[model samples]
Target: MDLHSALIALRDPMGIPFFPWLFQGLMVLTFALHILLVNLVVGGIFLAVYHHVKGGEYGRKLSKTMACCSTVNLSLAIVLGVAPLLFVQVIYDPFWYTANAISAWWAMVFLLVITLGFLSLYVFYLKREKHPSGFGFFGLFALVMVVFAGVIMSMFAMQQLLPEKWLSWYVVKGSLQTLGGGFHAFSLGRFLHFMVPAFVNIGIYMMLYAWYFRPRTDFDQGYLDWIGKSGVRLAKIAAMIQVVIGFWWLFSTPIKFGFYRNPVFLIGAVLGFLVMVALIMVQKDPERYAVPMGIVSLVAVLGMSAAREVLRMGYLGQFDYSIYQYPVNLDWGSTVLFLVTFVMGLVVIAYPITLVFKLGRGTLSVEEG
Candidate 1:
């Protein structure tokens, strides 16, 4: 069969199990959260680096602050990834297991590398010895390397495992060489484009978080003038860079033009564009717009990223993996269950807002009205 035909076959699963669409929705939600946190860590670190570098005499304090955020974001990146991964395995066990197995070495060593990265992460702050911001540099390096490894494995897995009609490794390599046009057959190219934006977005979020959680007393001219101004500038610039590089990476994939032709792909692309525009506007008027912009932009990002993953699972450009199929099952019970939780979640989210308003109101009454 032709390459495209083979690709479509990967999506042709034997059958659907359990509450298919509902589980898919859950998987999507969890995956989105995982990516959101991933960006925070990536962008957060570099922003911290930039802040510490520019803070002049305030460098130490700024570094310490940045370190705290970096560590927390890193932790969340790993911790919050559980549900999506489990759900992915449940549905795509063949693809997931096969991919990991082919790149077994990388997958196995990942634990050690992650541990080392964390050690570097801990050394970044836990120790006061050695170089200044010592661990920070190493931690940054380690994290980048680990992410790169994941990229390599993913590429190998996607092209290699997706039920390639049980083709042997050599035949696959031969075909890939003919198809990839002199590029390395097993390479994923994840590291080249994604790492910077990951770091940059995370940095932006941290700065944003700082801005969001600013103490009213400390919301003085200096804070706004120095930190806010500089932070906004860096984050927005990084945002622009991410947009550029993201497209570059997309096109770099063999899939390219046809990839965007997919309806789901188009939706993601449009939402992603909307998000960038919203973020830019918020950057322009941070106080009035930052919170909402950050939120909406994040949603757009998550949607785009999840769709991207779905496409990847389907092998967007080159081939669609046909090992699994999911029927669109309208799950009423699941819908009502999560719908109630969703509304309740809104109320829970509102509590903090209400408390903040109450405190601000009481403080304002004492001081003015």
Candidate 2:
């Protein structure tokens, strides 16, 4: 089917199919979850590495703590990724299958490589490995590499999914045009926009993690103080960079200006602005504004990210590389089903927040990383 036909099928106000709606819901949920995890891992590692390089006492612990968080986020990233894959298979099956099939050897091999990184991390944590100089460095590097692989896999998958007009299959290798890669499509500003905020988000969470894990000893207090300062500084710098790069990215995309028409995007931008400002303020006294602002900022950041993704996916829907089509109209039953699942997801996510608060209240022993 043509791109125009596919869009009408996707967005017809009249309704859509059961599987299509269900898969779309899964896609959105998983994509959002993956993005959140990306922030944690990407931003977390940068923060960890920074503190290590800057090595003060707190800098030492800060790096390890960030590593710990990065590990957890990596696991979450993998788990959350499953649903999106399934959704792609269900909704854009032919395209996904074709691209993945072509890249099958590499795609299959990536799993083992990613697992190797995680295993290495497990060993480090198991040994409680020391050396602030390299704390979390290898593990973070592994996770980042895995992310790059995923990006490539995604790019190839997407490139295949697009119809002939949006995409022209190139020469012998079947790889789409390249900026450079053994991985995802590395569009300069696009990737940087993806990268910078991830660092900021991770730093904020790490800062909040510091709050959750209060210092147990005088030494711990000294360490916590340093971690907090390092994290806040890194976060502010990263967020500022993201703001600049994000605008630059938008400026590069004349076509996407139409996509930003929804007021929600503007709201997201404003909220994102406030979030960084709050993150900056929190550094001064995390006890006062850091935690609260952190929560608000994280939510705002997530909202902004989600809004962009939704719009992006919507636009991609029209221009989907997938050469397939679903019926017009969202399946009514599927909408209800999605609502139920979404509520369940809210609860699942809420548990961590509750724990975060408990840690804050000292009801739960908030250990310093």
Candidate 3:
């Protein structure tokens, strides 16, 4: 009847199918992959819109490229999202499902919003070449919708941790408010904390895009230089903003001393800041450090994700709940099979991305915008 009682009632009877740590690890890894692609899609949309409006031959080419890649990125984000969702349900089902129930309407609408967003992006891609002006509006519209969808999902995820507030959120004056009016609470700093770095990530990606095609394409040296220089500058600025946003989110969170002082949080926060510094430092010679910068960016994602898990656990500690407390069924056969299939699926999915990059090494023909 109470929040703690409700959560206990909702937990899976089978408990975790295998080791709790292992599932948690898989969730972090898969979620990192999902968010990385999400950054590309979100950040790629920003770049595409910026370049399209600039109205230059190189700008048009890059804009079109990013617009086209967005559809692919969205698909990959959806694909990579499934595993983490499953793992989350496996380990944190009580929290996850309760959050969904609190915001039931918005939770259901998330799928619809994604479908519409994807369709809008597809339209943007198709029209970008022939109806450039029309596509720009569509692109902007799609970006807003997709971002809203992300915000809703994030709010639900965070809402789960605040079990104590769940009942208050669900009922007011002895009346049920389960519909939630398509609204949910989310941290502005936390949302921007992820969104800002996405731009930096995409900036690094653009530099690599420029570098890879520089030798093959007949693109003007000035244009390629602009790509490299602009990307570095953009990444630097975004990284700086992310630092401020990161701290804002940190201070805003109601963390206990143990969580606030935990080495996991400390190390992750420090490493993330250092990674940004490294990215800024590498900007002086982007071409040489593009690969390393990209890898470090991913490492930052992993570190941040781990820190998030730490915070989640710490929050649950209030109710004296721990993922390790979940009963284990020890289904090793299914667990091993799932792990193998997950790895194989990643390999399969990666092949196409690798081929796309390989093919992208060719010169791009610019369309007049």
Candidate 4:
């Protein structure tokens, strides 16, 4: 059988329980949230380690703050990741499962690595107060493990796009390779495109940090000013670097796909450019601009996520595959259940999130009283 036919044959005979577009849309939304939290985790942890090693009053304070935030963000990122992954499995089971099967060992190891990364980060966070510089290695170790996990995921994502190469990867010199130990494909440009944003998001996070604490009497105005200035500078530089990486990834795509002219991609690009411009405009008053810029960043991220989905469609289109054409059994019962449960979950989670927000800003007592 040809590659396209085989892909169709591999799809679930039971069909999806809802329309493919709905699942795809949810996947994009959840992925944007997941990736945003992931960026916070990665950038927060790295900054924590860097500041912890630097060891000054401001550095130590910032280090502790970042470490704590990273711990929280890591948990949220992992939880949010599940929804997008499930959506992918539902809408593109053939490609997702095939990619996993091809690198079964790495897939299994991914869980363990992430677990270790989290544990190491927590250990560093808890011990940093006592050991100070002594436990810096743990933070470094966690960062490496986290980055390695990302690399494995990137490899899986890249592999699924190249269905034509799967057979050769699975069979070497006429012998079936069942071990699934090899990493078949990766794109440095694409990986960097995803990773470079971590710094940008983290920089914005610092701006928000300053804004959040500005009203607190305990925080020094000098420190807040330093953080705001530093954040704006970092965000501006990282935003520029992200633009370069974005174009590098775009150029890396096959010219035949003409993604450069694709309207969806262009819209995403424009949103990104606007985000960068907004960051630049906020340099004079990061704390004042923090909330609006945060909202803008989220909208831009959603646009980019949509563009990412479009790119995936283009890649699979080469094989005569379209997610919108997926067979749907249309089980309204399950769909309703999922939506209701999802809404209820948000309601339940909101209370704690609100409490944390208030507590962080030292307003919990006022609200409670």
**Most lDDT-accurate candidate:** 4
Off by more than 4 A, model 2: 1-26, 49-54, 92-95, 127-137, 153-162, 165-167, 170-185, 215-219, 254-257, 310-325, 328-369
Candidate 4 residue 244 C-alpha distance from true site, Å: 0.3
lDDT of 4: 0.90
* Candidate 4 error regions (>4 Å): 364-369
RMSD, one per candidate, in order: 6.2, 5.8, 4.3, 1.3
Model 2, span 193-258: residue lDDT tens = 656777676666757666766743333666666656766787788888877876776665446446
107, model 1: CA deviation in Å? 0.9
At residue 73, candidate 1 shows an lDDT of 71
Number of clashing pairs per prediction, in order: 21, 14, 0, 0
lDDT, each prediction: 0.57, 0.62, 0.82, 0.90
Error of 1 at 253 (Å): 3.9
Single out the weakest 10-residue window by summed lDDT for candidate 2: 177-186
Rank order (by lDDT, best first)? 4, 3, 2, 1
Give the Cα-based TM-score of candidate 1 against the true structure: 0.72
Q: Tens-digit lDDT track for model 1 on 212-280?
A: 545456444454445555555666666676667667756765564366566776776676666566656
1-369: candidate 3 lDDT, tens digit per residue: 655666778899877778799989989988888888889999988788888878788789878888888999999998888979989989999998888877888877899988988998888888888876667888888899889888997898789888898777878889998566635578888778767878888888877866887777466777777788878778878888888888888888885636668888888788778877887688778877777888888888888888888888888888878889889998889988987997898799897877666666763334411
